[model samples]
Target: MLDLARIIADELAVKPTQVENALTLFAEGATIPFVARYRKERTGSLDETQLRHISERYDYLTELEDRKKVILETIAQAGKLTEELQAKIEACQQKNELEDLYLPYKPKRRTRATIARERGLEPLADWIKQLNLSKASAALTPEAARYLDPEKGVETVEDALKGAADILAEEIAERTESRAYLRDYFLKQGVFASRIKDDYPEGTTKYEMYRQFSVPVREIAPHNLLALFRGEKEGIINLTLDFDETEVLNYLESREIRTKVPEIRNFYRELIQDGFKRLMQNSLTSEVRSLKKEWADIESIETFEANLRELLLSAPAGMKPTLAIDPGFRTGCKVSVLDETGQFLEYQTIFPHTGDRQKVEAAKTISRLIAQYKIESIAIGNGTAGRETDRFIGDVLKTCDNPPIKVMVNESGASIYSASEVARDEFPDLDLTVRGAISIGRRLQDPLAELVKIDPKSIGVGQYQHDVDQKLLKKKLDDTVESCVNYVGVDLNTASKELLGFVSGLTPTIAKNIIAYRNENGAFKRRKQLLKVAKLGPKTFEQAAGFLRIRGGDNPLDNTAVHPESYAVVEAIAGDLGIPLTEIAKAGDRLKSVQLQKYTSDRVGLPTLRDILKELEKPGRDPRAEFKYATFKEGINEISDLRPGMELEGIVTNVTNFGAFVDIGVHQDGLVHISQLADRFVNDPKEIVKVGQVVKVRVLDVNEQLKRIGLSMRSRDRA
Candidate 1:
């Protein structure tokens, strides 16, 4: 285990102690968030990503050990378990390396060598391995072929020698040492090369991207490699690894030959070259290339997940009543009003095209709702009738002598969310249209909280999400959600079950039970009160209690991310300093004197203690800072009104692998392609923007017919 920890530390470029500490915490059931946030000092302040990598590597090493055990047992059963072989197996660090060592002894179906062995030619194969080139010419005599059988396909002395050579070739191919040497040589020196098959139809553009491409194994870009392999799998191209055959043959022959006999050297060279070219080269090349591609895909997906998590946790617009409108022509407009806490308050249908009187009535209805609810903002869905509805609402706000209610365009995934089972349960009595409006309003109020209720794919925030591996995408999306939810602590008192379900270590069942208990008993006034909920056991509490916040709890530390189990420790520190926890919250200057090392334990180390001190400095402080207002053009209501180089305020509606979709007071949300994400190269669109981010953009192109408006943030810098 210590050696495994050292290997992991070497791979990750960290101290062995850090890997051991992280593994210990992980083994003790501490989650990534808990270990990352609370055990910083032990791990040298490793972030969540680094800790996850260590955990994953630890699992891989454990699997490697298991494979080693299996290989040793198999070899012992075969009566071939030598001490040298056992030591080699134990020293293997990777799954691939262990498998390579076990390949020769692995059970298999009858092959050419197996057939020869069954034919009683094992003696001849052994003689060939010792290959006496001094008498090579004499050994090929007819009497030397007495064991050869014509029916078994060995016709003469020459045929027998050829058959024995074939057996030798197969044996060499299976040798663990030979395979390892070849694998390492290929990894360090091989080059990937591809070309369109000449036999393919002439002038075909299907494989144009890969018509001629070459890159060393180490230098190939992951995305390009994935694209090339995908094209090849789709039959649009062909790929191969390029290597110097003569050089490889020399390397293999050098290992097999020790004497300076000219005949022996020539024979060995011919044998090794034939074996590699005919049996091993192509197969090994393909296998290695596939493995490299898999590694690249894993890295790419990890990067994508990181970028997505950051985007999902971006700053929200905060809780405030918002007038949501899903505009449409034939069905009129769906409007809803939400209270300051994002609850559905009222709903109304507004039609602007029926006539001027209908338009006036719709305007009056909107004005009344805005006045009645004191709506802080208006959120318009960026769809077919969105521009018309925005214009109508703007005109109404202008005519009224009320506070200027900012009109913001929202993404159109709320309809999908509203029709979902989750939305139905939340608003059972409300119509789908009204629920959709409520979703829009809540999204504008706090995107992170509301968006969590909807499936990320349905939210239309990803590029090629439907085309990617569904299981992989879902796992990544779930991880992103958990990371986001944990990053912004959940309010235990007021958070909905949907939001609570995403909190770290809390399952959907526990989240539902917590809500049920709150409904039956009343609002929880302290962190300890969670224990009263059914199935809210000690283990779950240990994991989740820290992230669940109670704003006005009996103990101020309960409002922070400090766990209840650590209350005694905090009290001790406070007592030693001669101050109360509440007083420390008010003025944390005295906390500087509390020595964290004195409170360290096997479970709660100096790392966790320091975190507690930091939390006490500002209890219940929001990770997201203050919100800022976004400014939109006064009269612009449609994409047609947009001109090149004109700056406009836009809300990011959907973020995808390629780019982000922004609504600029236009009925259609324009795409800001990933290439135009910034002046520098943007690998993912989510890195630079996210869903519901209010960004300033400049119009690059406006297509009225197609309703496509090209937007850019690059010019926003100049403005």
Candidate 2:
């Protein structure tokens, strides 16, 4: 096998030393976020993306190497392996190529060729290879007549020749080079077309748009390819591929049939064409589809990951005593009150949307809660009865002594979390809807901390998320959550087990143990106290400590990203400045003025020193952007209220490859297509918007019957 690390380095445009160093750290169990943030010097300052690519590619190569060993061992034990065969297998770079090379020797059930050999036709097949009736031959039949064995089921010379043809066809199908050529040709030239199955009704499904679709394999978009495969799987459509069979037959003949004898050459030519149609076509076509699906899955998973990352890193509404409402029409609204730290204080019921009398009582109840708890903000779920409830609350605050900031929270995954095992454990006795309201409130308090409790898939920010490979989707989403959580360091004293589990090197078990310890022994005073938690050893602490912040701890550096090992360098810097460590916060200018070279040692470099100085300037600062929210236009409560050329303010609910879906005060989301995303040309929707962005758009068209709203940001920006 080639040097896998060196090859990955070339592919990613990084140095070999960087790959080697990163591999060493990965072997030592370093997390991607930790290595990207702290080990910049060792990795040549590679970012999180480069590090993740290295990790994923390295995994692929290692698995490939292991597979090669197994293949070699299996072939050798079968006594079919030769020195040249082993070299060829070892040099194969792609998994598909390796599988193709091994197909001829792979174990199999009884096949036609194998059965023909059993009928004592092997000798006759060898003779056919040498018998080129090119110059002169009495007749091919005369040679074939000698091999007829009636007792062995070969009744005549014709039957014997038929067995020889089957053997030749099998040989042509198994040639590795031919298989590769056909697979490549199918990818480049094949045309995929799907039509409504004859038995199904014409307008029975959402796949009607794809009923007459036809596109070349190479030109199909990733989303369209996935949709076509899904449509075929559901039996709504019959899918077929069109290709030039004559051209394929010609190529196979030129490569396999060299004999000029009109008689023998014609015999081989028939078998060659039969082999392509009967054996090679279907097999290679399936392979090409699988390869395309795998590529499409990768692209879709990446889009999902990018969207989830943006949603998770969205700005928070910060800490405030808040009142949250999960609105409903018939069931009335479920109200939950949260204290400043987001602990559920109380829950109640309100019938704001029921009638005039009920609305009056709802307003009085809301006013009392605001006055009693000193609530600073109100979060209303963006669901049924949401607009009506917001209007009700706005009217009530008009008479109140102090009003709170009202926000319409995207409640996509709140119900999923409320019904989850985590939610049940957090609020065992509360009603499900009440728990959902509490989640909405906490989502406003801190998005990263609260959203971590729910599965990223349930958040509903991805495009074709369910259609992609589940294992890849889960892994990428998990990595995204971890990156976001670590980017905004977790508060050691207040973080839940869900938030702690995503910390670098901290397992779910360790997170539970920390929470248990804190519940029993009180809040952690310093970073060193983590040693008291069960199963948290030196290595775990080393990787996780920098990301865990202990606010108001005894040692001030415990709250910053400075690892425990680098405390000595910090103390030395404080000592040279003639100040106590606590007063180091007042000497930011002096810390910057210090000669960084003088502080470097064998174990510490400029990278480490620079990070330390930067931390000293602002310790434990949140990396998320300041909070902001979109305000929906008043009186636009439903799809019927929208009109062309009406300007509206909306929040982006989901970003996809072709467009961004925005919530413009109607339950139905409006689409801002890529062409209308900006005044200028827009190649990527993500470049102009994200999952939780607040964007202004103009209504282009609204179909009330279809409940579809087409929006345009280009015209709005110019206006």
Candidate 3:
């Protein structure tokens, strides 16, 4: 634990004490949102982002320790455990390092070297190892012939010698220290070079990215390296680790040959070169390159996860009747209405095909919904018939004598949601088209809530999402969903089973049971009521209850992040003073009088107690609403209407390692490249902006032919 704290402190460049304090809060089951918002003084003002980073690193180190235990046990069982080995294993910081130490003991298939050892050539191989053979023929003899059987493929002294060398090579490859040293040396010194395959046809542009590409191991771009390795693996190209052979031989000779007996030195030199070239070189090169690619993938995924969390937490329209149009042509346009709280109200079919009376009826229906239910916004699906529908809605609004209703394009994954089993259960009576409309309407009201029903990939947020590793993409996207769900507290009473399923530590089965319990019993009146739900055990409750908000519950703390188990502590605090637990909500000054130490326990430590006191101050407060809102030009609807230097409001649709894409009143989002993220240099796109964040950006360049808009957040010019 101390070592873990030290590593985190060193990596984050903070004091061990600071890490210890932060970990204490995290261990006590405090949410990152709570710690960053309320316990600022304890964490040295490390924001939620920093706290989350520390928490993740902490979990990784714990995993490393568990792996170390398994490796140590495996080595012990193999009878190879020594005090030195045990100490090294205990101190190991990474999984790769521990696995490297355990490589020799790891079980493997029988190879050529194992077969040679099984034959009576073991003694002969030992004799060869001791021989100081400057000349190869001096050590060669017919007496070494008894073990040299042509039936087993060893026909002569040369064949036996070659077999002995193969044994030596395998032994060298298995040596933990030798492999480690060689891997590091090569990674630091090796240069990666690739050439187009000879049979790829002359002047092929398929691998133009790697044809002339050469970079030092340290300086190579991860994406480029991954692409090249992928090409090579697919037999589309040939790649090599280029290095001067003489220099490599000299380095190995210096390490292996202490005395310069000419014959012995020559033999060792040839042996080292042969062993490296035949066995270690290519294997180690590929391993190191794989490690580099994995590291890059992790970093990219982490960046993506952070951006996705922010985007999912972006503010929703919050319980307003909204008209969602899934724009289309031959299929006609699908329209649906969501009630004040985003529940599906009604849906209808409308066609605006070039010219149709249905278009006018659609306009009248929208206006009626706006008048009847006070619909604040129209969420048009940013898809096929989007532009034409936008024009239709604009024409309708221009002739209206009512409150100006804002029309916004919705990124509709509604069709996917409607087809899902969850949607089927939610709306069994409705058709797929009606469900899609409801999905679009509800998405505008609360994107996070509606989008959680569909798979994130189907939402179309990334570049080359389908091409990447599916398991990796799903894990990353799931992590993003978990982080987002926890970041924005879930409404215990109103949240759908899909939304609740995304909450940290809660699964779909558990979420459904919770909703079932709610439906059977009533709305969850307190966080403790979750215990009554089937399959929702204590551990699941501990992880999820803090992020669930129960409004108008028996205790005000239930409506906030305050855990149910801490109710006694709050009661005790209230008892210490002349007040009731209910009055503690209004007695902010008196609540602060209670010392956290007085209420400390194994589970409810100072960290947890301190958080409980803060929640008492402001119950049911939303952490996200403090952020700014998105506002675009009233009349600007089409991409062609966008001119260079026009300042307009936009919602960040997706954020990548490269940049954040903003949907500025167009079906296609403009790239606010990492360089244009801010006036200053930005290392990560999430640092300056995030997915779903509303930011004012200026049009820097517009390429109509390419259907691309280059935007910048730096300028303020309105053309």
lDDT of candidate 3 at residue 42, scale 0 to 100: 76
Give one clash count per candidate, in the order shown.
0, 0, 2
Pairs in steric clash, model 1: none
**Candidate 3 lDDT, tens digit per residue, 522-558?**
8878788888899988877877877899877887777
List RMSD in Å for every model shown. Answer: 4.5, 2.1, 5.1
Worst 10 residues of 2 by lDDT: 130-139
lDDT per residue, candidate 2, 488-588, as tens digits?
89999999999999999999999999999999999999998998999999889989999999989899999998988889988999999998998887796
Question: How far off is residue 601 in model 2, in Å?
Answer: 2.8
Which candidate number would show the highest TM-score if scored against the true structure?
2
| lDDT rank order | 2, 1, 3
Query: For each candidate, what TM-score against the reference?
Result: 0.83, 0.96, 0.81
Per-candidate local distance difference test: 0.76, 0.89, 0.74
Q: Supply the global lDDT for candidate 2.
A: 0.89
